[model samples]
Target: MILPIVAYGNPILRKVGHDIDENYPNLDKLIEDMWETMYASNGVGLAAPQVGRDIRLFVMDSAQIFSNMDEKDKEEENYPDAPGIKQVFINAHIIEEHGDDWAYNEGCLSIPKIREDIYRAEEVTLEYLDQNFKKHTRTFNGVTARIILHEYDHIDGKLFIDYLSPLKRKLLKRKLDDISKGNIKVDYKMSFSK
Candidate 1:
């Protein structure tokens, strides 16, 4: 089941969600659908916020297909190409963060067709639970680093574009304004000052 993804102007995308006490009814199904959506859309990450859900959860799978320097996915990565598996995080919390900053190109499922170079911490240690409510702590770096960073922002009502320079922000202002005007289907009603 492919879930319906919200676009760039919807208000729900901006809301800071609360922790999930339990995997809500249909959560298992939603995870399945989100996995489908992420694969079908060529995205390594997908957030509940992008799908119009205000839950503190998201799914990430980065080893889908890595673009080769020679062609546009014309050849599969050296490995057999893992189609992508669903990783669920319900009511996740980041207990600590320790790392250097680095820049990498990133794209969003919600804001389609737009890619930008973004800087994020090189390493992060997070404590969270899966859909089954099992606790886990994982430290990730590099590409996986990018994956978790993107999804976590959804829970915090922040976007990768928010970390851009003032000049770039000004350049994207018109587009964001267009987003606010309903040109795109994103949810930007955020509240994360707490």
Candidate 2:
């Protein structure tokens, strides 16, 4: 099912998500549904807060992207992690933000079709946990940088649209409201709901 992406103006997007714990229920299924919702909505990444969960978790899938590069090419390009299947990040922690900022065409699943050029760090280095709860850190570039940045925003109580200019933000306000209301396609109730 396509889980409803909490829209831009929603208060949940502005509320920092709380850290997850051991006693929390449905750890496995929550990860599964996040992957399903991400694919169904044609998103490469998603955060729990984006789905109203208020938990420090996000899911990412980078399939259908560059995956067959040779070792030499990967070394030269510096993008080695071609995402496999759907990976989950729980209790993520950003230890550093590095490199200069560059502008790219960015959009949000919550905002649907609206797209804009947003500046983000050219590269990022951070630590996050895999589905198995193992810790890993690596540099991300290009589109991966964009995806991770967007998901990080969910954890920090912010949205992509918040970075827009006043006039541009005003222009999107009504559309955002419409998307938040009921005009856009979303499925909040899942194969199971809490």
Candidate 3:
């Protein structure tokens, strides 16, 4: 099933998600639907908050980014974590962030048509549970790290737009408002706040 993505201005997006355990209802089904929804929406990552669920869960597939890139581009932009990872993250927490900050144009399914350059650490070490409630600690770098960071923010009541400067945010006010009120066109299903 393809769930409607919660739009910007939704209160659920601002609420910190609670951790879920293995016994959470229909955990397997929700994970499956999230993957379907993400692919349908052309998104590399989707958090529970995006689907109106306040839970510390998200799915990411940075491998898609690499597969879509040509060999030349891949060679020039060498990301050691290339051909990235596809996995589910439950009760995720960032243990540490390393390396200098780099800027990347980031966007969210919740805030469609809005992409901004956000500066984030080049690498991140995370502790998270997998689909089967198996615990794992992993470090990610480059685009993969960025993707994880973005989705991780959603669970913590943060948005990529929150990283923007005051002036930049002010400039995007109208577009942001439009998105909240369902005034824009998006190919995938979205539930607007207004």
State TM-scores per candidate.
0.80, 0.80, 0.99
Worst lDDT 10-window in candidate 1: 185-194
Candidate 1 lDDT, 1-194, residue by residue in tens: 77667766677878997776663778888888888887777677888888878988888876554442345444543322233234787777777666778778887867655679988886677888887889999776666666888899998888888888899989888776665554654333222211
Better of 2 and 3 by lDDT: 3
* Candidate 3 clash pair list: none
**lDDT per residue, candidate 2, 11-112, as tens digits?**
777888887765569878888878888878767899998787888899876553456545686567544355533567777777777788877788777777
Best by lDDT: 3
- TM-score-superior candidate, 1 or 2: 2
Q: What is the lDDT of candidate 1?
A: 0.72
lDDT of each: 0.72, 0.74, 0.96
Candidate 2 residues lying further than 4 Å off, grouped into runs, are: 67-86, 185-194
Best by TM-score: 3
Ranking by TM-score: 3, 2, 1
Which candidate do you rate higher for lDDT, 1 or 2? 2
Candidate 1 residue spans exceeding 4 A from truth: 65-86, 178-194
> Whole-model lDDT for model 3 versus the true structure?
0.96
Report the C-alpha displacement of residue 1, candidate 3, in angstroms. Answer: 0.4
